[model samples]
Target: MTKKQPKSDATRRRNRVDSSTRQPKPPKSDPNNFHGSNNHHFLAIIAVVFVVSSAISAFLYRRINHPSLPPSFAHQRGLVKEDVTFQEILTENSRVSENVTQRHFTNPVLAYITPWNSAGYDLAKRFCPKFTHLSPVWYDLKSQGTKLVLEGRHNADTGWMSELRLRGNAQILPRVVLEAVPKDLLRSKKQRDKAIDLLITECKDIGYDGIVLESWSRWAAHGVLHDASLRKLALQFVKQLGDSLHNVRSQRNGQPLQLVYVIGPPYSESEKLQAHDFGPEDLRTLSDSVDGFSLMTYDYSSSYSPGPNAPLTWVHSTIKLLVGEGGKSLANKIFVGINFYGNDYVVAEGGGARAITGRDYLSLVDQYKPTMRWQKDFAEHFFVYSDDQHHEHAVFYPTLMSIAERLKEARSWGAGISIWEIGQGLDYFFDLL
Candidate 1:
């Protein structure tokens, strides 16, 4: 009844305001507020998807690009398996053989075979034509009282020897090491006679064309070379052995047996102060007795320091010392030793260096993708790399170019070359031979 009586303008306006507030006035539209809440949820979902997608992409990329290497590469970087087939080796050798020019070498090309590495056996058969003499590192001359006994005859492969002779006409000279005491063989005439007879009998019985005797180093280690009287007796013993072997005939080829004397390199002046092994004097003394002198020219560096395996300068100096004034005649009989292996040294603490094969050299190259460098002075290949644990390493190895340089140098000196053992080298190494 009171509201019906109120008809004033102020009253009407106040009543209208009150009615609008109570009825909510059909709710106004605020575009920013409405869209902001919905956009926040949409952006959050998009962000999560982007983050997950990015993580997946990164993982996939790493897996696709980088693969794990063999477990053997994990430790002992020096030793690695030559993961190649015989046919693959033959294929590579065939490719290398195509570019080879046929040239006759006046001197013998000796290749050594080791029983431990089966690759040497296969390679010897494959590249038989490249060598004039094949020396299997077998046979040790040990003494039992007055009688002399021979060991390591079980390693002889008659079938392999027969194949080698037939295919390449190479002489099979089994390497003989004098494991007996120096006094037993050098001092006693009866012992020397027995030793000579033992070698000759083995050569005749085993169809060996010759014997590669390695006793000077042993005798030198035993201080036999230091004593004047013992040295003379040692030379006489070698002469006697050589003369007896030359007198005997090989059962396989009616030819006189050959005797190769393995001699150590001349020690440096500093090294001579410590110990003296066989030098130029020994080479000359045994020149008339032995058919060939195997000069050990490698091992210029030791594991204590990172240096070349065989420095070119050192090699030249060594050859110069041995083949003195107009000594090309002696050089013809000398077989310069060439190493096919390499060395890897770790620069970090508790790290040491070791000898590495071609396969091992290649594995390191693949894993690290390091910058390879050619040591111009030493004529070798080397590189530096960091391992997974951030350890730095230096590697020195022989390449085709380095090996070719050595071959050319030896040929220039009119000296034959002897690989330490063919198994330690790459398949293409025989191409130089």
Candidate 2:
């Protein structure tokens, strides 16, 4: 495929301008919040706006611009350089010949998995059966290829150094995310910027993809975005921070393929789930902001009726909710999530809690596997019992059988599938996805 150069229109602007100049801070207002005497959006809208505008400017000026880049900013399109240690990892993983170092992960089975330390990587492979794990952070590459990687956390102290040692020549920590604090300087933008700026500069200088923020909601919305008092300070800090990595791909912590936010099943979730009411479009907006959305379809209703075997229609409708309601563009990006654990309740004389954990459920299954029989339900799975206490129970786990059931859903939905957390599944749950 040719590197298509988009045409330019009234090129009133140059794409070279960084986010600092773009996302302006909102006007100030008297403030009162937890972080007392404060107000403002944390990341502001500058980076987003600048990135979007650049695309536009690039298109409009494509046909007539000189050098393509505005001025001293022209560089060849090439692979984002990989960190030394991780480079060795890729080399080992990507080996092709029958050589000992032919490369373990050259084909790029999985793009990016999260919190993917050694254990996480092992567990993830169980569900993402076909993909090999790689670090999205340190594995810098400009274009797509068979580059498989997983997300790993890195603080200022370790950076990529420790990751390199642990992963050895097999796994690579290509990128690093500075999940640190100036503890002393957090309240002051100047202090915060200086701290963050230092990390960002190191990342760019050393060659990293970019930074992964502390998921936006947990980030800006925590009162910072709304505060009007210190908004300008916050904006300046963020703009400078963004500039440190605007051209960089992403802070490796975030994998490339968008996340499919698994919408918990409303019926089973009861009231514990948040955001269930958010329709597909709302989900789509959320999805657009990041990567994608996922619908969780685990049932605890019956052995044959449809809880574990949720009514085909319900499943179809849920998928439609995101695709049709949210628009196919967004919906198509949806990935379905399946349950990997069981729920059971041990009522305590009239008013006890009903949510029993996997450990307990396993015990019951063990004690009853000989005498107890369960029927699949319309939602997920269930075992019939009229305990002397009248308690209810649900069963699920990503055992071989459970995984088989999930695979059917992932393929049918035409979206990716991810288990809630690898921690919940059986040890060998991913033995075969």
Best by lDDT: 1
Residue 383 local lDDT, model 2: 41
Off by over 4 Å in 1: 1-95, 98-106, 270-275
Number of the top TM-score candidate: 1
lDDT of 2 by residue, 329-415 (tens): 554455455544444422112211222323444555554442222222121234433344433322332233334434444444455
* Model 2: ten consecutive residues of lowest lDDT: 10-19
**What lDDT would candidate 1 get against the real structure?**
0.64
TM-scores, one per candidate: 0.75, 0.42
Assess candidate 2 and give its TM-score to the true structure. 0.42
Q: Taking the tens digit of each residue's C-alpha lDDT, what string does model 1 give over 62-109? A: 334433222221112222122322233223432444323332344578
